[model samples]
Target: MTVPQSELQQIVSALQKSGLTVESVEDGALIQHGESRVALFAEADHQGGVIVRLHLDLDLYVEEDSLPDILMGMNLLNQGLDYGTLNLDPVDTDEEGEDSGVAFAVLGRSVLWLPDLGVAELDRLREHLRRFEAEVTDAMERTLHGSKGLSA
Candidate 1:
């Protein structure tokens, strides 16, 4: 179920052709689109399917005191999504602990039948990523500015 090297190459090529700057990693690539950057990798799962993991870091650094409100907002956002999850990522904290900043991110994945996939399949994946990116960006903006719609 692992994606063939050919498919992987196709994925990278498609991204590049779409105007995304891509950097190859071990099994996938890092893609930059406007201010949104994502890392995509394909791997085989135990069920014998290729899973493409799409990860985008929501780099909104908020004050510790605002983390709860932001998390709440993200939870509300997640409840409305068909794909991906918004999460409070712990890796972005500084040594100041609570006095420092907090971070959030969006992660999405989809399974594909490698033999049946082509440019169209890649386009679908890209569309999903684009939607996730927009939602995460808007959610972060709402959280940081204490948008009146968000509840702590």
Candidate 2:
């Protein structure tokens, strides 16, 4: 939306009405779906549209030594996905000041104006979030079993 603030409220309302529990954050909303969570932030684009960033966090975790394989699997999985891009996201650290496990995420962004924000668009966004969670779950399971991500 042109006015980022007002449009953000509309987006949050739509999300809540669609059955997702959205909590207002400083800049946007936070949504939790099962074991996965998504943080959506709204910002004004240069063209007067609003850019909504959907950072979907998966429940997948990988140890330090498994980083390489996990990354490869993530890439392979991304190649087969129709939306979002997988990436390594940092997690909490250990007690000895050593880095702990890592989490994978699918980052998706939508740019739309006030006129384009509607039920159909909200549904599309929700669907994409579901897809991302599924892909991450699959990739992690396959990686842990010593597979090279999802087969194309």
**Highest lDDT among the candidates is held by which one?**
1
TM-scores of the models, in the given order?
0.67, 0.65
Q: What lDDT tens digits, residue by residue, belong to model 2 across residues 32-143?
A: 8776677787766677656677666554555566777666666676677565666666565555544544443333333333335667777766786677656655555665
Worst 10 residues of 1 by lDDT: 107-116
Q: lDDT values of the candidates? A: 0.65, 0.63
Best by TM-score: 1
Q: Please state every model's RMSD to the true fold in angstroms.
A: 4.7, 5.1
TM-score of 1: 0.67
Residue pair clashes in candidate 2: none
Q: How many clashes in candidate 2?
A: 0
